[model samples]
Target chain A: MNGTARHRILRGCRALALAASMLGAPALACTDAPRGTGDLGLIVERAAGRLQLVETTGLTALGAIDGLGDLSHASLVYSRDARYAFVFGRDGGLTKVDLLCRRIEARVLQAGNSIGGAISQDGRLVAVANYAPGGVKVFSSDTLELLADIPAEYEPGKRAKVVGLEDATDGRFVFSLFEAGEIWVADVREPRAPRITRLRNIGAQPYDALVTPDGRWYIAGLFGEDGLALLDLWEPEKGVRRILDGYGRGQEPLPVYKMPHLEGWAIAGRHAWLPAIGRHEVLVVDADTWQEVARIPVAGQPVFVMARPDGRQVWVNFALPHNDVVQVIDTHTRALVETLHPGKAVLHLEFTPRGEAVWISARDDDKVVVYDTATLAPRATLPADKPSGIFFTSRAGRIGL
Target chain B: MPARHLELRHLVEHDCGSCHGMTLAGGLGPPLTPSALEGKPLEYIEAMILRGRPGSAMPAWDAMLSEDDARWIARYLKAGTRK
Candidate 1:
């Protein structure tokens, strides 16, 4: 209890802190290796057709993998085990990557052009939505094996580009036909012989579609029509219904430099936050009623309106010239709470599983910025090359990712 | 090209670059390189810029872009200048 004893304790604490830093551990006393692939995620370097592997916990990049083909509009789905990544590239490249080995296990060009893809509920089948020679192709998630090919033919010998492909429960896949104005639900219960149920003339130019988290509803946003077409997967006999009719009826939408990404739909509680195409607003629609409840004006054309996992707040990003800013809205009040300038051309925003932190990808600045969700303060910044989408391993367990 | 030519050009290279590649090699949209635009007319390209092809991913830029801006983008795209 004297000066010499206190000095000794202080020196011992200092020595422990120094050793922890030297061992690349946190200041606290514990011995653990750096994160493994199970704790890792990916950031797409679009132009290079590569992915930067990163450890989600440390906010540090592990390595980069190349030869991914065209990744400009690429999207990925992780295996159920969280040990593999199924990357669907724009050039129709279906690649299965082993996270542990940090290398591609298998790769194949499945189509001429693809927009994105989905994994089945059981994580057994991988489905890709194609734009050219259009259709949806289902592959075995394990080896990228060609399981079944369902060409999206609008008419006999005439094909239509498919978009918004999402896998629902019970091994069912739903997607919209861009040119045919139809929505098809393919029951892949029998993988090779997919039983397709088509609802024709649902709307005009269905740009993109998404399924609710519960996998009950398939909503397609129409480009040629003002309203969105909704299909109740549970009751396909009910057919497609129209919701939010004449959304752009009286107003001329401002020039949209980039199409609003529908994958940005965020469901918080009972309301769904969706980006209003060509508008600087995020539409809050009742998930159950499928009706517009409120419209939250934002700083720019809202591109991605993602909700934190806890469903308390929704984060929105904008399309360029205003892509430098990001805004967070309190879901309870449906009000904009804060806006942060992440960097130049904020392309994508992703929140950690528990909503503890959010990662933002700024393409122009070539940096991935991570921020603490509660404090709204920057935590770490890692250099990247034109990063677009950030995907976490936690997605492996979720449906409709 | 006008006084804000660089800005507009960057817009094509960056903003339009969102769909079209940053280098204008094309992603969702077709490539805008000189070789690809060789047979296409400048007026057609400018029209496509000002009034986007509806029912597709392209959106009209006439609201935010001046005629000069559209023409500059058309010319720049046809010239195949990379960023």
Candidate 2:
């Protein structure tokens, strides 16, 4: 074929890809968006007493649902099956919405005061991190029924406040207790009656914990006490091995000075990329050997760290000072790749299962921004009223239940 | 006067110690003890009660309590705990 004919053939293939994505079903529309490459979406935090779904296909404003009043600190998670998206409200209510049906099917009252939650890989359970009266509630995926309310066991003379929860690949759940400086592990195989096992004295305050893909180890981000705590899940009794410390050096620890330190961590391949929020950089540690391999500078206040499914590049979200954008870094070279501005207060982010697009919750704007992965351009914005926590389902053709 | 002190005591037990220390000794913030309130004058204490200590976790009680109610809290913290 002639050179011009070959070029025409490539362009024709690209156009077909775009057209096929547009014609895909609504449930699969989210996956069609570029993932690990940075395509984003918005989950609007609607005003108190109302619910609204803003379709991001063309960034058009969708209608609203009334009666779900002023939900503060709302976190959303779509099931693995993608049949239902559970919205856990701060007021202790869990609103179950069917994305395909485009309506709330059932509302479970008082699913516990939640900051956010993680849905199981199998879509069997939704583990909610209760902020107040610290604990977690494991709810059934299909019925949205409350199965377990596992409270963090407070040590003698110590107060424990549950800050975050993340589900592990192995039928277990990890809960971070901020005040107690501990992470509690619970066996959720039974769901209803979970056995709580305390992993104590991890750090000054364990703010967040993330399990590896294989669920062999758990790494927690300590807020006040800088650095990450690596816990051996194989032996939960031994507690965490203090691997890395002084995440953002030069800043004094909390209760002294209020500069935030280590805030978020993401596991990519054999490297654990940690966002040093106070220092405005990211620290990469070899996951297997657990040693600092590289340190790369990034934009201001990198809070949330997310990676591409292929572990090629790591994305960092800068949260404050009116510059809400994501910084992409090359994992191999540990170099700055691109900086794409999404919106204000980009608190939480997630990539589609297929690694095509990235979705971010714009807290200040009450909307979700979806960006294309390849171009790193803002593709679409989903209108949400005060949307905070956002997650995408791995299921191929199902929307939220 | 004793009845008022008793009521203030009850309020301290239920409301004050919940976030602060159980004995008003301080949990999330400074204690409510005499030492914690020392150098803080009666009027200053009243303002702190109504407006709350800024930059700290202390939330303003202007919406929850009135001026007189705040004053009562000040008096209780200063004198009512004296027995």
Candidate 3:
């Protein structure tokens, strides 16, 4: 096609109203919207095994793509260019979705069960943290082709489930082994042949973990014990050190209805806001010293303790019985600033790239509510079905999301 | 009774599905599928609903669900009612 013809086609595509195919039909034929995906994102319809491609600026879903299997607790990472999204399904299916085309580009079942995944530093590779066979697998970001597999073998014939896999500054991937109380860093400078470094006895039952914004520290939250394991990627030779040691020192743990995920951890200003497992408090710790500064009691067991881009306010969601509520804390005052109920069973929340707005997903309500960060007022509500995780293409540029 | 029964079902699929997997095949928790519970007795499943396994992440649903609700869920899982 000539330049004018191409321009006409692009204009026509943008002129056409996008019909979000909720009935499993092809989303749109002429889907090249003649725009960038910077403000675009995806919402996981976990029960229906589909994803609704949405744009943050309009606060509306462009279309829906289906056929993803067992998306329970699903997550997605974007390519460096922010064009493609690598969706990691709970059924071990890694689907490469074309955000512009609104279709599945490539997909593969990498394991029996998978928790989540992260894109490599250069965005050339995508890594998945597996639960069934207990390992991490690397795939070509473009083709979804398996390149390497690193099993979390803590003992002979025994493998522990891998969690908290993330990308560091270089071509390295870091993750934690849940059952073995270990952390593994795989250097994928050479994709097929990874250089493995294992740090053992970090802590027991690391339910989930997260890498710091700068990819400096990898922290794993322990479910079997008190405290977390922190490994400095800059100084791996120093081994792992336990931080926030025994915050549960004299308290009895309330029943944790759901496992607290460290993915939502935040380091605002000089302190790190972390969720205390089986406890109703959000632990405020000095990032440099790793000492407990203040424990801010919340509405319930905190699930995600997230920070706004400005680091002025921190938002937290809860586990069952209190999952409907979201509380914000002012880092400076170290006090609860606001409390709001987005809807029933609020599963996940994501702030816009610059933190001007936040989108929260309430599974029971089947809608994602957008809130203005400044006023903390509801901006818009987009309907969905059993929505869980909201991932924006802005994460494409971040180190560890 | 029917409305509450449907709510209980939704609770099982959504609330319990948070950990048990929506299809009940399992994630961090064990599978609640019919095949995964073939040999397990119905009473055991119902009792587990009321009194969750101690020392594990599973919390007793007795606070939210009644004995009748637990029994209904046990049968519902064994039936493997497809969504």
Q: Judged by lDDT, which candidate is best?
A: 3
Model 2's CAPRI class is: incorrect
Model 2 chain A: ten consecutive residues of lowest lDDT: A33-42
Error of 2 at A297 (Å): 1.4
lDDT of 3 by residue, A80-99 (tens): 98989999999999999878
Compute the DockQ of candidate 1: 0.40
Candidate 2 stretches with Cα past 4 Å from truth are A1-42, A46-70, A120-122, A156-159, A249-265, A361-368, A381-387, A395-401, B1-83
The TM-scores, one per candidate, come to 0.87, 0.67, 0.93
Docking class of 1: acceptable
> Roughly what TM-score does model 1 have, to 2 decimal places?
0.87
Q: How many angstroms is residue A145 displaced in model 2 relative to the true structure, after the best TM-score fit?
A: 3.8
lDDT of 1: 0.83
lDDT of 1 by residue, A104-162 (tens): 77999988778889999998999999877789999989878898999999899998888
How do these models rank on lDDT, best leading? 3, 1, 2
Models ranked on TM-score? 3, 1, 2
Better of 1 and 2 by TM-score: 1
TM-score winner among the candidates?
3
lDDT of each: 0.83, 0.62, 0.88
Kindly report which residue stretches of model 1 are placed more than 4 angstroms away from their true locations once superposed. A1-38, B1-38, B54-57, B62-69, B79-83
